[model samples]
Target: MNEWERLRHAMRATERPDAVLDLATVMREGRRLRTRRRVAGAGAATLAAGIAAVVVLVAVDASGSGGTAPTERPPPVAVAPPSVGVSPTSPEPTPPPTVARDVPPPKALGQVIDSGVRYGTDQRVYYLVRVSVPGAPKVTVGLAAGRRSPNGYLTTDLLVNDVEGADRSAGFHQIGYDERSSTTPVPTFGYFVGPAQRIIGTVDGQQVDARLARWSFDKNVVIFWFDPAELAPGKRLDGIIARDASGRRL
Candidate 1:
């Protein structure tokens, strides 16, 4: 208002308004004002654009450094151990078969025979040949192949199964072959001939007398010894007869 009023007053007081008014100077001032306004607007727009560019750059840098990209790597995968294979074991080998020895044929009474006996046991078989004499109390004679002794001797025994006889307490009457005594020679043959308690019999039509004696090992068993030469193969005593000590026929 001051500038406009002053200007109007100066214009009215002018002696030659047309001449006082400097058209060229007025035109130049108007141009200068327009230039100053244009310059001010350009400076404001430049400042605003610079500020927006700075904010955008700052956001871009922040996102690049800390927003999406991962700082730490993922954890490593764990590895497992390999599986072990098992092998099958074979069964143990079968044991070998055992062989059994053959038993000889029985040649006489008390001789051993084969009854399918095997080793590793106390098993045996013998021939059964017996004689029975008649008496008030019967007397029976039997034979058996005894067990082998630890000294490696096999003995044959003749026994009276029923009654006891003279030797009550004593050792063996004789040992045919003593394994303990190396100097004692083996006898070729032994004989047992006697009037044994008057017990007599007939064998092969010959009047054969028996020597009745009790076993030293078992005093209860009465016995009679026989010569192997007198017993032929496949021949046994027939028509047997006997008499006891008290003259009792048996």
Candidate 2:
């Protein structure tokens, strides 16, 4: 056989006898395959761009230089640790000293309750008298001083005026018997309406006894006095207190 026939024979042997070749169908399949390849390439390019964009964003975030400004975070707060052990308690407050309630027997106005000679003076005499104040609802007491003449005649002068609103219901009422002067030493005196057995006075941080007197007419009214000697210079009368038979302060 010639070379061309041999070549024809080889082609015929490679071709399937049962298969029918359709040129239109082959063209349609080739076009579809090419379209698929184009689509795949475009997808790969788009994915590469997206990956590049993500890499740039990561670099910017790590550098902390660009993109939307990072949200501002508030500073951390400081908290104190809990305390341990027992809590201290406050001390109780001391109550103010008060006097007992006692009513005195009623007396006529300007009536003398007690009388005594003034300390450090012979001619001067002091007297405690019950008196009534104008426009006041309760009766009050007063202290008066007088000088005695040789003929037994007496001239009187009111030393401390009666304090309005002072009565037997009060804890106690006090007045200075005489003013402190070069010639006369000041004596402190007062009266209380109670069953107090004794009167207490404070001088220079020490407790001292006060002379007490009770009138036969008004036994409920107790008169008390502190001598001028107890109130010397630099010594102050801090307070006055009355006590009952049981030693309880009234």
Candidate 3:
């Protein structure tokens, strides 16, 4: 009993008065602590989001500055080369030269039929002859005049006619004729198809004789010429007549 009583007295001596609790103050302090905890959690979430954004920005800057980005290149172009052995400003090619051809001289066929000298002029002479050519079907008859120079060279002028369709049966078939009225004494001459013995020419109502000759190769072909001095001034030969060997008109 004593031990129990002593233990009880010690307890009573150490014990104080009973504590009084304030409900309203305790509730307000509890609410304020809960609010502070919520605010601190929200602030920590915002700080984590800001740190993630900064890391993403650093990664993008590193890729661009370090030259690791992909880029596209343009396509290649075509070009033409210059031509060989040619120039833009060069001249055109030249053509070949032309060549000249040679010509042949005229050839005679028969002997001279008639020849005569001008009156009082020995340096000038006239003649009649015939020539043969390669392409002609018949012989060509020619009347020619020649003049001699002081150097003993002779230059000739010739007038010719073709005798392809002469009428030998007629009294006269004229071959060719020429008159030189510009001379001091007008000269007239002609050749014909004939077998005649004489030829007469009339001028100014007077009869004049014409010298007649036959070709050595054919007697049917004849030539006649008149003395130019016998013609009166300003008058021409008006008519011509021929006679056969029997003195008959031909």
The candidate that wins on lDDT is 2
* True-structure lDDT of candidate 3: 0.46
Tens digits of lDDT, candidate 2, 176-222: 44443324443555566787677766654566666666534455666
In terms of TM-score, which candidate is stronger, 1 or 3?
Answer: 3
Q: Rank the candidates by lDDT, best first.
A: 2, 3, 1
Once superposed on the true structure, which residue ranges of model 1 sit more than 4 Å away at CA? 1-142, 146-152, 155-196, 216-220
Instruction: State each model's CA lDDT, in order.
Output: 0.34, 0.51, 0.46
Considering every candidate listed, which one attains the maximal TM-score?
Answer: 2
Whichever of 2 and 3 has more TM-score, that candidate is: 2
CA shift at 174, candidate 1, in angstroms? 25
Where in model 2 is the C-alpha error above 4 Å? 1-124, 145-158, 181-183, 233-236
Cα deviation of 140, candidate 3, in Å: 3.1
lDDT of 1 by residue, 148-235 (tens): 3334343332221223221221111111211222222111111122222333334545544433343333323334323333433223
lDDT of 2 at 200: 69
In model 3, residue pairs whose N, Cα or C atoms come closer than 3 Å (at least 3 residues apart or on different chains), thus clashing, are: none
Positional deviation of residue 197's Cα in model 2 after best superposition, in angstroms: 1.5
